[model samples]
Every structure is written in C-alpha cells, then in structure tokens.
Target: MTQSADEGFTTRQVHAGSDARAARPRALPIYMTAGFPFDGFDDAAAHFDQGDGFGYTRTGNPTVDAVERKIASLEGGAQALLVASGQAAVTVVLLGLVSAGEHIVCATHIYEGTRGLILDNLARLNIEVDFVDDVNDVAEWESKIRPTTRVLFAESIANARNDLLDIASIARVADGHGIPLVVDNTFATPYLLRPIEHGAAIVVHSASKFLAGQGSVLGGVIIDDGRFDAVRSGALYPHLTGTGRLGGSSLAERHGGLARIAYLRETVAPRLGPTPSPLNAFLVGQGLETLSLRVQRQSENALIVAEWLSTRPEVASVDYVGLPSHPHHALAGRYLARGNGSVFTFTLRGGIDEARSFVEALRVITHMTHLGDVRSLILHPGTTSHVRRTPEEREAHGVLPGTLRLSIGIEDSADLIADLSRGLDASHPPLETVEAVREESGALDVVVAA
Candidate 1:
C-alpha cells in the first residue's frame, strides 16, 4: 500500500512503502547487486544526470530505499536516510550542517555516544559544542545560542536516566534563532512520540535499538520535517544557501524545504560511505514490521518493573519519567502521553559494591551494554558507559556510585521480578541495618508506618 498520512501507526508500519497497485512480493526483497545494469551509453548518461534511479549500492539501493520510506513514514518525516550506524547518522548530520568555527548547543541529558561525538570527535574538526544543564529550561537553551550556533540538539527521552526533553519549548528556541532543532528520538520511538509534530525540525534514530527490536542489525536513520527554509533562516546555513561546490545551484535552491536531507542523502552519507548493506536493510525492515508490538510490550513491562523497583527497600531511587515521583513527571505527561520508554537508571541503597552484587546476582536479565532488545539488559553506567566522565561529572548527571541502568524488554513481569528479587537479596542491607529499619518503619510501602 502506498501509505496515507491518515493510516494508524501499526497499519503504516506493516504496509508503508509497499505499492498495492503494483504486483510485487509480499515480503520485501533484498536488492543485493552492487550496481544496476543500464540499457546503453545514452541510458547511463541519462541516469547520471537525472539522479533518481539507482545506479550503485553505495549511493542507492532498492531494499534500502524501501526501508527508508517505511522509517520516514513512521516518523512523519519528508524523507529518511539509512546509514551504517547511529554514530554515523549523527556524524552525517554534522557534516551536512556545521563547519569549522561554528557552534552547536546540545542538552547534557543525551547518550554518552553522542556526547563523545560532540565533545571529543567533533572538537577535532574545530566545531565548538556547548551543553545546556537543563533541557526543560528554554531560557537556558536561548542563553546558549550564539550567532554562529547552527542547531539545537537533544534527546526526546534521555537514555539511562529517562529525563524528558521539552521538545516544543526547545524547538521554539531554535525557531526563534532561525535554526533547526534536531532531536534524537531513539528512546521514545515514533510509535510513542513524533518529535516533528511537536516542532522539532529533524529526528534521528539508532535503528539498531528499538526500531530493530532485536540486538542484531547495526543501522541508523535521519529524518527531516522538510519545512526548514534556509533562505528564511538567514545566513546560518551557507552550505545550503550559497552556491554549491563546482559552482552549481545550492542544496536549498535545488530541493526547496528538503535541502538538508537531500544533502545528507546525496553528499554527506554517500561520500562518507555510511550506507547499509541490502541484507541489513532487509533485517531493519523485518524489525520495523513489528516495531509497535515490541516497543509497546517493552513500555508496558517497563512500567511494571519500575513500580516494583520503587517499593523495594534495596532501591534508593528510580529515574523513570513514568513514575509520579520523578522530578519531570509533568513533562512526561505533557510530551510522552503514550508510555515512557523502557530504558531507565536507578540507584541502589548502598554504593558501587551493592550495585555490583545486584548486577552479578541477576539471572534472567542479561548484564550487557546494549539496549532496546527483546531480552532485558542491565549495566552499570558509572563504570561501563560513562567511566570516562570525571567523578564530579558522573555525580552531577545523577550517575551515583550504586547506579544501575535497566532496559526492560518483552519478558514476563513476574519472571523479571523474580530475577531482580535474587539480585536485591544479594544486595540487601546487613542484618543490623534491616532490623533498625524494620523497627523504625511501620508502613508497607514508602509510607513506612506499617
């Protein structure tokens, strides 16, 4: 079916990018050839000039195109580009935008991968990046924007911590500056939230995560709203506004509102060689076929897990936005109406030793660094993911000594609770402390009057 904007997410997920008018295979076929055959010299010359038809896999592929359509449809985007990895997607976007001596204002609540890419990797290219301490503070966001600031970047739902980004507010800030607001919507997949509808100019996803559902294929996707006008935005994006290389028309002049994404597809992604394999693209398509189901299940299971953990004596705090106790629950209610994502971090009652015991005692939940899988995964962020961050930086970001991040999956809640029970038991306080707490507390839950 050629997708309609009116179609529900699940319907579109299953049928988008398919042409019902054409007789084709029910399943998406992998166009595995390195290059497509041309009719003759004239046809080849025409293909080179016309630029729509697929000529080479590195620049374009049928299987990859189909998957890109599905993703763009799902994300409510004008176009999508599938790349090699999530990091590649960010790098491609950066290459498309900022040049040397420019600046990017980003949120500190983002994943470590992006943080490193901006602070460490991008710095090498002389692209300055600054992080805002609070994503909810529009004033703070505005304060960081400079004349050279090219974009505003943040996560819809931050990884590990589950902090919510006030996308509309930040987008307003970006719009005020005549710049685009780029949101990493990996955690809160399009099944849950479409950042574009909330005013974000662009959305990117680590398709390897929830979009793939399984911990298999390594892929990334970038989606644009196709509303950004470089001409209207003044001179912030000269790459899109000025004459193109070889003295051709500028990107915006050539593609109108779709200039940025077109640049990424035609120049940044292909030139950088971040194109995915046909088989990998096919794998991503299969994952997309069940995107809603897997993410919904994970969201539901996550709420259950969060509720159970909150009442545990071994757990000091749960950083899930779904919980009313979260500092930003109101933001979650306003933005993530469907369900809070599954990835969240919580701290143990004790320090790193207790967290280690809790992690090592887990049986059903795998202790791994990866997330957005069919199986529940656990990891200690302080030591595993953010070990490079200074002690003050980690603590400032709420990564306590005993913090453990959980990416809940489609497992039975009871079984997950059972595995966590063993971990809690191993990490439980000493006998004297338990006795003192029991004597002092009299409530069944946190009320502590039982």
Candidate 2:
C-alpha cells in the first residue's frame, strides 16, 4: 500500500501509497478513525512502544501516511509529516530543532504567520530567531551563526513577494556549520523547485495553497531529506543528540536516515501535536494529481500579468524572478528549472490608498487572504498579512505601503491583464503604459510575457 519517489511525478501524485481499494472507489477514501483496535496489551505496546505500523490517528493513520508518502516522494525526501495548518508545520519543525535559549536564523521575507511564529509563539518557548536580510550572501549568514544556532531557514520563493533564494549558497553555509537547512517551499512547491535537490536537508510546505489548488483545506507538510548529520553534531542539537525524554530512547538511534521525521512523529508531534485530518490529507492528495498542469498554467498566466504590470505607469516596481531584470534572475535558471512560481508583488505609483483602490477595483481576482487557487487573488501585506510588524520592521524587509502581492491562477492572460488594467487605470489615470521611457529607471519592472 506504499509507493516510492522513483515513480514519475504525475504517476506518484496519483498512485503513490494507494492500494487496490483506493481504485475500487476511484477516489482516496478518508479513514476517519480516532484509534485502531489492538488484539491484546502486548499488541498495543508493540504498536506504541515501537511503531509496528498504524495505531491511532493522533500518532499515525493510513490516510495520513498515504498523503505523507505522496508528498515525500514528490519532494524527493526520505519521509514526510502532515499537520493542521502552515503555522502548525512551522511550530512543530522549529520546536523539534531548537529548545529554550537556542537560536534560529530565518530569512526576513518569510510569511507573516511564520514571522510571528518566530517572534511570538517560539519566543514564549524561549527559542530566539535572528532574521537576516541578505539571504544570498553566505558570509552574512556565517556572521549570525553562534554556538546556540540550531537551524537555517528560508523560503524557496516567498509568499506574496517573488525573490529567489540562493539555496545552494545557504545550504553550503549550513553544511559548513553542520546545521540543517530548512527551506519553506510553499510558493515554489515541488513542481517548480525541490529544495532538497539543491542541498537543503529538509523542505516544508503550506499544503493549503498550490498543493491544495483550492481554498478549502488548511494543511502543512514537512519533508525530511535524510542527509543531515544530527548524531555527529551532538554539541548543537541536544534535543536530538543527547535526549532521553521519551522512555530513554536516544535521538541518534531512533531517528537516523529519516531521523528528523521519526523524532517528529514519535516525540515532538505527540507533544506539539497538530495532526491533519484524513479528509484534509485526502483532499490535498487529490489536489496533488493536477499540480503540474495547474501550476504550469498559473505560472504562464503570472508571467503575463507581471509583464503587463511592468508596462503600466501606475506600477512603481514589479518583482517577479521570471523577468530577466530581477537581481536573482541568473540563479532562477539554476534553482527553479521547471518554472518561476506564480506569486509575486508590485508597488503602485500612489501609496497605500492607490494600492487599496487597485485591489478593490479588481473584478476577476478575488479580494482574499488565500492564494494558489484556480482563481486569482490580491492583497496588501502592510495592512493584512504583515500587519503585526511596525512600519520600521516592514520597510526593513522591503514591504512598502504601495506594495501589492498577486497570486495569479489559470485564467486567460488577456482577461487577467484586462482586469488588472482596469484597476491600474482607476489607481492612476491620465498616464499611458511606461514602455519606452521607463526602461532607464532600472527598477525591476521587466515584462515577462509567455
């Protein structure tokens, strides 16, 4: 009833971890059981003491395992774990790595919920996070590393803003320091970029977005690449290296090739527990089937929209890595081999009011907080997603008052462009498309048509 990553992408998406019964219904069924039956006390002990397969929904379930395997295979990782929401995934992963007084280095352009998770929730647990601005500079990361630093985290393609992180550079830095590199590939997804292939040790995803491809489910997933030397670096990760908390089981022994995942499932997940419902997992798995097709169309439409926005006078600056004008465009060919993801940001010529008006004037795109759906969406991070941060902090991370993030979907390019054109005209009238004169501005407003 288990499938491996060696299968094709579409094939793995459809058939991975699915049994004959799955085909009988022609759909993934939800095993909505809270607990599994055991023959005797010893059987229950064997199931819990050592994972002798399925036991309980909280600990593990067949439905969860099916989706986990599918995602792991898709991401080219050794194992996977599913959780309730994107925040839950971040919380569980961070808690598993660093403890009280430990430190983690994260990129400044992380999602607002994740940034708040680091600032508020993890801080409550006494774990500290140092947000670094220069993600591409390995030396800058090296400067932040201290004896207490436990992990290096960044997003492959940021949520709302589109900037490509130099994964190989960051991974090299993490490798040099013997710390695991965690890349949140929520925006890029495995279809466009698998961080593990670029030397990342682990990959995290907000399955709610593109992986779900609909605004229905809220789920998250963590993929373990199974390459980190956790046991060798005992001094840094005591929770994994010198642990005797869970019935005297050493982290070194219990979690080895897929150790992080094993540790998460057996020890951390049980405590920080936010298990995904079988129904949600099934929904995500179903979404995974058309991931390539959906994202391809989305990316194509996104590039067209980014191009159209760049030509408009109402737009101040556009930032999508697919454009050759991006600072990270050179690395895009290396990192995102398949496609540049569909989420990106552009600032209006007018400030917050113009941005708000532009978003409100939109007709086709939904005015919502969510992304990666069959329909387009737009939001202003300064007021909505990143509202928790002060103006100073927002500016520090390139989040300006006029900035508008777009998550383009599979709609027709002309329709999307027309919808955006209507909004742009309403925001700043009497100005034509800045095609010729704006070329010398050198701001990142390149048109990425096709």
Best by TM-score: 1
lDDT agreement with native, every candidate: 0.89, 0.84
Each candidate: how many clashes?
5, 1
Candidate 1 lDDT trough over 10 residues, lowest sum: 441-450
Candidate 2, which segments miss by more than 4 Å at Cα? Answer: 1-25, 246-249, 431-450
lDDT by residue (118-174, candidate 1, tens digit) is 888889999998888888898888889899999899999986578898888889889
- TM-score versus the correct structure, for each prediction: 0.90, 0.88
Encode model 2's per-residue lDDT on 240-291: one tens digit a residue: 6665754576667666666667778777887877988899999999999999
Where does the lowest 10-residue lDDT sum fall in candidate 2? 441-450
